[model samples]
Structures are given as structure tokens and as C-alpha cells.
Target: MSIHRLIVKSAALLTAGIAIGALLAGAAAAQQKLSFLAAEYSAKTLPFWEQVVADFEAANPDIDVTLEVVGWNTIHDLTAQRIAAGTMPDLVNTATIWVPEWVDAAAIRPLGDDLVDATLRADFVPALFDKGAVYNGENWGLPIAAAARAILLNKGLLAQAGFDPDAPIATWDDYRSIIVGVKEKTGAFGYAFDAKGVRAFRDFGYYLLNNGGTFFAADGRAAFNSPEGVEALQFLVDLVKAGAVPDPLGTTLEDYQPMYEAGRVATMINGNFAIAGIKANAPGLEIAVAAVPVKTAGQTPVTWGVTDTLVIGKAAPVEASRKFIAHIFSTAVRNQFDEAEGMLPVLLSQAGNPAFTGDPNIKAFIDMLPTSQFDPFHPQYAQMQELVKTAMQSAITGAASPKDALDKAAADFNALVK
Candidate 1:
């Protein structure tokens, strides 16, 4: 070869070698490191989570995932705080109510409309994916677990009241009569609610919806303080006055747990988590779960349905994070993870799978899903909770009429949004 040709060939070889080395280095650098934040209950189901995570990592050997266990009470605040501090995990599990807030803050990254598969999205119930995941016209998170406010009754207690425990409690009037009969005959309070805790507000939300009242308007204005809301609040107050529930002045969610376990309360209107707690505390007791009864005949039954979503943090690598999220919702993982935690699975396929259907009691949550009321997809959710909490405490404590209290709460909530 001529000297010039030799020189040109040598240079080309050097350039190709450099390009190959750079490609290898870039590939290595693309290996992702991710962490997920979840509650202790889910942490206890770590083995199931591990199987799911291991499958994902095995499929994508370049990724490493770490699970961080968060305490339930602080997870919401912790998620927001870390995101605000610019130290958010790659993925975090949070309540549905937090989705809109995080989306507004730009703390959560969307799946990008192009990446969301139409078939997969269609597999999700429209009402759920639309109302539960979408906020301000954006999808913020994917649901993993579902929760709903339902009535948990002691089957033995109802039988003692001369009613079949397996029979559905269809109306508030029927439930009330049974409660009074149980109270009169057995000398036990027939119902128990978190009369003093933030949960007190949830009952009003559930019952108001049960009575055909909307909790919030499409514009996010308070709509629950209407006649239905007032009537629901009065019913709760009456339960307290009639000695069906413990003193409204001195009851918390924690208080009701033990009371129900000890058989002091014949029925409880609480979240699905109560199932696990009840089983742990009173293993031998016969218990049944039912949807919140309708307020009057011909009214469609409704309940407070809640969910926790897994959101990819804005700081996460988009493509890899999306894959991990998709894996988490895979049929095998969602079925095992949700049932292990005593929660409803978000995947439509697993929603009523035989594995979850073993317990007939849990059917109430599944049955109510079509009509359940979701918390408003408001960006000001945390603030709205505060407003509702204050009004609820005031009404439950008898410091203000339910109408005045809820009306003021609505005003305050609207003001915060404005």
C-alpha cells in the first residue's frame, strides 16, 4: 500500500476502535439503579415483592431495585417531602388522593401518552383508570391496591339479633333496626366509627354518596353539604346518641379496632384493612363484610373506594421505570401482592380472580366498585383533607350543626383552591 493509503487506513481503524469502546462504555453506564417506597404491610409481603422484582431484574440484568419500607401514617408526607427536597426514590407508592397533588407539583412523571398501550389501558376499568389515575387530563400513577369503606359486621352478633348473617344489609333502615335490636338484646353497642379521628370524615363521605349526594363537583367545589350530607351526618349523630356507637366525644379509629375485636361493637364501617386486623385479633369470631347500605329504597348503593398508586418519580429514568411499573402490574405479581396485603387488586383480571374470591365477605368491595365514589382528583387534596377534617370534628363533637359545619368546610375548601 502507498504511505498515504496506509495512513488513511490506520486512522479509520483507530476511529472505529474508539467508537466501539465508547458504545460499550455508554451501555455500561445505562445500567439503572432504582428504589421503591412502600408501607410496612407491603414490606411484610416482601417475599412476594422480591419474586416480582427478581423477575424484572432477571429480564433486565442491567437494573437493580431496592425496596424501602415506610410507615403508613407518614408515607404521604414523606413522599411529598422527599420529592420537594429533590431526593425522591425512583418509584413510590402513595394514596390516590396524592396523585393530583404530585402531578401538579411536577414531582411525578407521566407514562407519556405515546408509551401507554391502548390495549393495556383498555384492560383497566374505564371508571378506574379515568377517574382514579387521570388528573387534570394527565395520568399520574398506576394503582396496585384498592380500598373501600364498607360495613364489617360480626356474623354471630347479627344471628343473635335474629337475622341471617349471610343475608345482605340492603338499606340503612334495615341496618338501623338490626343495630337497635342487637343493642337492646345483647347490651353491646351495635356500631362503632372513628368518631374523633380523621376517619370520622370518611363515614360522612361514604354515607353521603350512599344517599345520592356528590362529594365534590366537577369544578372541585364542595357538593356534599347538601340535604343528603346533612341527613347522613344526622344519622351518624343519632347512632352516637342512641348508644349504637361509643361516645362521640371520645373515640378514635384505634379505639374501634379493639372494641370490635372484643365484641363491644356488632358492626364497623371501615376500610378493607379491618379484615386483617379482625382476623388477627379475633381469629375465631365469625365476621362478614358488606357494602354500605343504601339510605332509602330505590337509591343506588355507594361506598368510599380508595386506592394507592405507584408513581414513577420525575427523577427516574423514564424507559426503565416504565418497564418496572408494567412488571409490577403483571397478572402474577398484582394477584399475589394485593391479596397478600388484604387489599383489592387493581388489575381487572385479578379483581375477581378465584384466589381473591375465596372469602365471600370481601365481595362487598368488589360489588361496590362500579358505583363507589372516589375522592376528587383535586390538586389541593391535602388541603382539602384538612378542611374536611376540621368540619367533621366540629360536627361529630357537637360544636356546630352538620349543615353549618359542612357548608363552612365547603367554603374553606373552595377558597384554598382559588
Candidate 2:
């Protein structure tokens, strides 16, 4: 073998090695595709999600993303079916209320410091990230929007009832008086309550929180059976007994909409989403939105301000999903998505963006983020809501005392958590 023969062999081997490496890299890139099943965006024209995907793909050409928007009503069924089949999407815009249960079911993975750096954590509203996304002390997802339930009161009714339209309702006693006054002056139900079903839990939840109580105690025991809980339920029962609020054993807000529209309901409690609906139902109706009245004076305002969260499934490629999470949450994309969805921006700096500032109703909800508390993130949350409803109805219908009804609910809650 001469020097020329050796040199030709070495060059041929090097060229083959380079070509093989390129082929491997292209194959790896092709395999880096992510499937995201989301709700709400799947049907929108010019969806903000599509824009986010396009921007992400532009910045990251090597990764492919598939977005499937499922309808809000059907997404839960789809998620359950997919999870049962072990075919959950790589990323899912999880039903915020169910994220904890998903974590418990081993459907999603808990994100760690490696995947969520300080900068990424800091990008979201601190309280939202801290309250809405954490489950059992672990950060399990990211909240994309923030909204809270507030009180919508008709100023005209307040004035007619000899109450100052500008004065905010602060205590249960005062709220009761207003309810009575409205009934006396206008002969209309002062409060339109949705107390007939599971949603009844939320209507009473206002009283529970304002009284400085929680569903579960620090020891992980069901504690709403305590005095605070009794006070809350007793108040509702008293209202129904006094005929200030009609029997609300199985009704929901939609049922009360007609009453609200007819000017027969003085105050209704609901979330930011209700503003547009109320306007559409009665375009001439004038109302004021404020933090729900507290159980007592001098208590800090509190309401369940929820955020829509996206979580990565356990079967998803963690690295790719993480990169997508980071990309989708970039300030530009986040602000735009929130604006289009009529949601508050997750970032603190965007608090004053005219996009959010222009809507006073949304602003009231946004200003509440600081004082809001996310509902308990537990697998038993739905059951808990039902149990609370049963207890409330039993008390309101005179089937049991407040303490007795709540005691039974505590037993049920304890059994579920057990």
C-alpha cells in the first residue's frame, strides 16, 4: 500500500461518516413532533393558539406541533377516553379544576426546576403561579388566564331600596338588610342564587372564604363543618326562610338570567364571563361589578380567581413539550392570546396594557387576582362540591340543622379524601 492509496481510503471513510451523521440528525428532527389537544381554540377562526404555533414553528423549524382544539363540553370526555387508552396528547390544555386529579391519576408529570427555570416562573403572575398551578405543593402546570367571580348589583334597585348605590356591600348582615330592603321596596327577590345543585357550593363559597375558612384544614382533614361553615350555610338558610332569596335547591345562573333581565333580581354573583352575557341579554341593563361581600367587616376580599392551565402529559416527550411551553409563553404570544380570549395577562407588567384596561369589568376581576384564592385542587373536588350542595340544600329545605347537615358532609369529604 502506497501513501496515495492510504490518503484516498481515509477521505472516503470521512465523507461516509459525515453523510451518516446528517441522516441521523434529520431523522431525529422529524421525530420531534408534539400533539396538543386543547379546548376553545379548536373552533376559533384565527385562533391565538394557531398564531402561537406558527411563531414557535418559525423559531424552531426542527420541531413539529399539531394542535387539536376540542369543544369545552366534550374535552373532558375526550381526555378521559384518551387517558384510559394511554394515548393522552403530549400536551393538553387541562381542565384547570381537574389538573390535580390528573396528577393523581398519573396522567401528567410534575414539572421540576430543570424544566421550569426561575425566569419562566417569574413570567407569570406570582399569585396565579403560586395559587392556581400548584397542587399538593408541586407546580403541575402553567396558568394562561386569570378571572374571578364578582358581585353584579343593579344600582337602580339599591337606590330605590334606600341603600347608597356607591356604598359597597361588606358584611353578611348588611347584605341581608339590602336583600330585605329590595324585597320590601320592589317586591323582587333581592338575591338571585343558584343553589339547587353542585354550583350551590360556589355561591356559598363566598361566605366560607370571607369568613376566613377553608374546605380542607392544614392537617388534610375536611374542616368546613366548623363554626365558619355553619355560619355560612345558616346565613343562606335564613335568607330562604325569610323569603329574601327564593328556594335555590337545583337552579343555576342561566335560570336566574330571566329574573336578572326582568329587573326582579337585585344582585347576582358570577364571574367575568357573565359581563358580556348580561349585556347581550339586556343591552339596556346597568350594573356594577365588585368583589363579593365579605362575611364580616375588615376582612380582606377573597374569591376563587381561576386560571386556565396547560399541562404536559406523562407520555409526552418531556424535552420537546418543555420547549413548546417556553415558546408558547413568550411575552408577545401570551399577551396576544389573553387579549383575544378576554383574559388577564399572566404577566404583572401587562397590568396596564390598554388591551385589558379598556374593559372595566375585566379590570375589576384582574384587580382581584391579588386577593383571590384558587379553589382546592383535589381529585375529590367535584365530589366535595356535591357533598356541600347536599348539605346546603338539606339545611335550606329544613331537613336538618346547619351543623347536622355539614357534619354529614364532613364525613363524606373525609371518606373521599381518605
Candidate 3:
């Protein structure tokens, strides 16, 4: 071979080697590590979350995801600790109300337009997707499941107590009367009150709202000790004192699930997402969705709505995180998750379907959306929740009189609300 031809051949080989090395490097760089820290989901819907994680990782071999589910009761405190230590997860599944506090601390990033695409966004129920997730004009989270509070009544229990199974429970007086009657005749706890853990405040808030009370007054200070607030707390204490409810100081709804399954709990305050659980665990038990009993006669029946969201930290790998989120919210994925979770699908394409509208219990929850108000937004929402939780637990446990507990909660709230 000629010397010139040999030299050219060596140069070509060198170039090819360099090109191969560069391609390998690029492939490695494309691989992303994304961590998702989510609060614990219900038994029925938890597997779906695991499935989504597996599916996303499978479809995108270039990306890796770490899924960690934390106990709901400790998520708030744990998330704060993680963020303070600069170890906040790339993505977090959190309750909707947490957004304001997260935003105030600059912990969460605004989702890019692709993740919050117009077409996909347009599919959600307007009030939920459009209003709930939007903060300061840009979207911050992907709403996953929407739930409305309701009174879960075991209809068979009502019949045995001589109450009309078909009658809608209206006033709180009637609610308590039924509770006492159920206790007297059946020797079972008439109510299962979750006065412990993160659920305490929201569970007790039903009474606060029914009594026409507000959490914060006009100037954004704690006003929950109003006559209505006092009334709400008193009822909680009364139920415990009257032995109409199980001791609720240190327990959650989960602790009473077996009771409900055994038909020992006549009624409880829970979200509509519990309907499927009731049917699945205690089959053939007649059930009804009653209006959350109100305090005043002739008052409008009302309930609160809560939405959970998928949040991305500001320091996250935005591109990859956005892709994973968009994938899970695709029409098929969101619908399946919502159905299994017993929550209202945020998307109209799913929520508007007859599948949700046709069921009377589901329909009752849906109808509440129009009047379902999220608690007023505040930067100290997490702290406020804790304060209110303490008041509920203390009152129900008889550690403090209802007035003392509520008044203290109001005072503690003032320190933060300012």
C-alpha cells in the first residue's frame, strides 16, 4: 500500500474512535435521576402509583425514578426537615393547601407549559384544575385527586335504631339524637371521630363550617373562637363525653375501619373516596350519604373540598420531572387512578362522564363542588392546621374545656397569622 493511503486510513480510524466515545458520553448524560416523595395513599389506589412509577421508568430507560411513600401523619414535618436540609425530593405528592406555604418558601417550581399543557389542562374540572392549581398566575402543581367531605352513614345501623333510613340528617341536634339512640339500642359507638393526626383539623372543620364560622377574621387573624367556633368545639367534646363516639384523642379513621366493617360505627365524617372501600370491605351493608349535619335550623348544607397535587421542587431536573408528570396525567392514567382512589377526577373528560354522575353518593359529592370552599389561603397554613389539630385533640380528650382549647388555638393562630 502507498504511504499516503496508509496515513489517511489511520486518521479515519482515530476520528471514528473519538466519535464513538462522544456518543457513549452523551447517552450517559441523558440519564436522569428523579426522586418522588409522596404521602401514603389508600390501600386501593397505592398500587396504581407504584404502577405509574414502573411504567414511567420502563418507557424511559434513560431516566430513573425513586418512589418513597411517607406516612401522611408525618409528611408535613418530614417535608419541612428535608427542605431545610436541602434534601427536598425532586417531586412531592402533597395536599393542595400545602402549595401556599411551599410557594412562600420558594420550595416548589412552576411547572413548564408542556407539563401543564393546554389540551390536557382543559380536560380537568374547571374549578379544580384551573383555579386550584394556579397560583400567582402560573401553575405550580399537577392536581391528582379531588375529594369532598361527607357524612358516611351505615343505613342498616340506622334502621335497627328506629330512625328512618331514608331521612336526610339535617340539624346537629338530630345528628346527636340519632347518635344517642344508636348507642342506647345497639350498644355500639355511634360515631368514629378521628381527633388525632393530620386529619383532626379538617375532620372537625365540618362543624366549624356548619356553624357558619370562619378560621381567620377580616384582618387575617385567628377568629376561630367565635360563637360558632366555640359551638363546634363543644359538640366534639359532647360526643366524647356522651359516649356517643369512640375515644378519639389518639386515633385515626383507619383505627375505626374494622369497627365500621363490623357495623359498630353507625356514622362517621369522611370523604366520598371511602364509598368504594366500604362496599369492598363490608359488602351488602346498606349505606347512605347524608348531608354533614349542620348547627342551625334552615341553614344550607355545605361541605369542604380538598385536592391533592404533584409538586416539583425548584431544584429538580425540570425537563425529566415534567415529562414524568405529563405521562401519568394522560387521560387513561388519571382516570384509572381516580377511580381506584375513590376521588373525583379533576378532568371533566372523566368527571363529567355518567360513571361519576350516575351514582347517588358520587353525585352528592359532585354537587358539593359548586359550594365546596377550600379554607382561605395563608402562608402559615401548615402551622394553623397543627394549632387547630391540638385544639380538637385536647378538647376531645378532656385535657382542656372546649372554650379553653379553642381560645388557646385562636391565640396561637394570632401569633402566626400576623
Candidate 4:
């Protein structure tokens, strides 16, 4: 064998090895794709998620993303069904309320040290994260948006009643007096409530908390039978009996908006999304918001704050899905998401951004976060709401006593949890 022959053979082998390595790298890049499932198959979910995807893709240049817009109606149930059928997406959007149940079911993975940003964990509200991610002592998801139900008071009506328009009704008694006085002076309904439904009662979860009771105990037992719970329900019921609420017209959260527009109802309790309807219904009406009035003299006021969370499903390709989840939580992407949806931002710094700050009504939702309680953490919360709704309907219609109705509800809920 000649020296020239040996040298040529070695060079050829090295060149082939490098070409193979390049091919493998190219294939790996092509195979990396992240998929997301969001509530509402509409522009609200996609535009924001896509913005983040675009930014991430530009920076990485090697990953592809697919975004699926899911409707709120069936997203959670469908996601679970699909995962059971072996076809879950990489990531899913769920109400933060479900974090406990989902994590308990072992239907999701723990996001370890890999994806969480220390700064975000520190800067973001711990309560928000505890409600959204830390369930059963584990972090399961990222809180995307923070929202609370607020009392939408008619400043015009308060003024007509000779009350201070700028001062918030500080207690349940104050709210009652103001509403009754307004109706007497204006010939309008004192308060507009969801006359025949559960939201009126369900919305009182805040009142329950402030009064020292929860819909469910941390042990998953029904706690609505407590005195605080009964008193909360009676607060709304007494308002009805006093002719404060309009005719038991069997209304909903949406129904009261029109009444306010017609100058027939003084105030109502609802969420940030309700602002659009109010503005449209009563463009000229002076409106303001405040926290739900506290139930007791010493009780700290609380409100129902809902969160939309991003969770990686059990069937997700955990490593790749986490990268996409973490990417969505980036500061720039979060601001874009809240701005597009008209939702209060979750990032501590972006809370007061002019884009969302222009509406003071939104601030009520953001402000309630400190004393807000997430929905009952039971997996069967939907069932519990239904049972409570039924019981309250019976109670309001004289078919049962509030105490009896709630006692029965507690029994039913206990059975469900069992």
C-alpha cells in the first residue's frame, strides 16, 4: 500500500462522517413541532398564541408550532377523552380551577426546573400561581390571566339617591341602603340580580370567603352548610324579599345589563368581559365598579377571581411541550395576550399598561386578586354548582328553606366527592 493511497482513504471517510452528521441534524430540526389547545376556536385565542409562536420560531428557527382553538364548552372534557383515546395535544388550556383535579388524576406532568423562570415565579402573584399551578403540593400549570367578578354600580343612580358617587358601598348593609334608597328616589329597581338562577348565589362565593367559609373545605368536603354560607345566600334572598331585586324574572348575568341600560336597575355583579355589553347598552350612563361588599364588620372583602391556565397534558411530548408553554409565559407574549383579549394582564409589571389601563373597570378585576378566591377546587365543582343552583331555585320559590336547601346540597356534594 502506498502512502498516497492511505491518506486519500482517510480523508474520504472523514468527509462521509460529516455529511451524515448534518443529515441527522436537519432531520431533528424538521421533527420538532409544538402543538397548543386553547379555549375558544376564535381570534381571541389564536392571535396572541400565534404572536408568541412567531417570536419563538424566529429565535429558534428550527421548531414548528400548531395552534388549535378549542371552545370553552367542551375543551376540558374533550381533552380528557382524547388523551384517554391516545390523541392528546402537546399543551392544553384549562380553567385554573381544574389544576387540582387534573394533577390528582395524574393526567399531567410536573414542570420541573427546566421551564420555570425564577424571576417570573418571584414576580408573579403567589396566590395566582398557587391557585393555578400548586395543587396537592405540586406545580402543574402557568396562570395566564387573572380575573374577578365585580359589582358594576351605577354612579348616576347613587347620586340620584343622595349618596356619594365616589365612595364604594363598604358593606352589605351599605349596599342595601343605597340600592333601596335609589329605587325610592328614581322609581327603578333597587338591585338587579340573577333572579331565578345560580350565578347570583355562586357569585356570592366571595361573600362566603370574606365571612370565613369556603364552598368546599381543603379536604374536598362540602362546606357550604356553614353559617357563613347560609348568611351569604340570605343576603341576596333578603334583597329579593325587600323588593330590592327586580321581579324574580329568572334573569342571568346578561339579563341585568339591559335593565341597567334602561335605568331600571342600580347595580349588578359580573366579570371584566361584561364591560363591553354595559358600554354598548348604556353609553351615556356613568358607571363604576367596586369589590363585592364585605359581609361582616371585620371581614376582609374578597371576590371571585377566575384564571385561564396553560397545562401540558399527560400525553404531551413533555420536553418539547414545556418549551412552548414556557415561551408563552414570556413577558412580551403575555402582554400581547391580555391586550388582545381585553383581559387583565397577569404579569405584575404589565398590569398598568395603557392598553389595559384605560379601562378602570378592568382594574377592579386586577385589584381583587389579593383577596380573591379561585373557584372551589373539587373535580365535581360543576356538579356542585348544579346542585346548589337547584337548591337555591327551590328556596327562592318558597319550595324549601335556605337552611334546608343548603343542608341537602351539602349532602349531595358530599356524595359526589365520595
Give the top-scoring candidate (TM-score). 3
Predicted candidate 4 versus true structure: per-residue lDDT over 278-363, tens digit per residue: 67667898878877888757777777778888787666665666567667776677777776665667777675577666777776
Q: What is the TM-score of candidate 4?
A: 0.84
lDDT of 1 by residue, 1-418 (tens): 9999999999999999999999988987888888888765644565766777888999999887887777778888888788778888888878888787788778888866444566666666566676777776777777767777788889888888787777788888888887888899888788876645656667667678889887678777778788998888888877777877787557887887788889888988877766876888799888888778889889988778887777778888767776787687677777777667788767677755875677766776677677777776767766666676677778877899888988898888888776
Per residue, candidate 3 scores C-alpha lDDT tens digits across 260-363 of: 87898988888888888888888987778877878978776667888888888988986788778778888788778777777887876675566588888888
lDDT of 2: 0.80
- Stretches of candidate 1 off by over 4 Å are 1-30, 113-122
Off by over 4 Å in 4: 1-29, 41-43, 50-61, 195-201, 247-249, 356-359
lDDT, candidate 4, residue 61?
68
RMSD of each: 6.4, 7.0, 4.5, 6.8
Question: How well does candidate 1 score on lDDT at residue 386?
Answer: 67
Better of 3 and 4 by TM-score: 3
The lDDT for every candidate, in the order shown, is 0.77, 0.80, 0.81, 0.74
Candidate 1 vs candidate 2: the lDDT winner is: 2
Could you arrange the candidates by lDDT from highest to lowest?
3, 2, 1, 4
lDDT of 2 by residue, 1-418 (tens): 9999999999999999999999998788676889998778323424777878888888887788998887766777798888899898988886688897788779988877656677888867778787776877787888866668888888788888888766777788888999989998889889978777546888878888888878888766788888999998888888888888766975677688678877889888877756666777788877787677778788777877767788888878867787898887877777777665656688776766887788767777777777888877667777878888889888987899999999999997888786
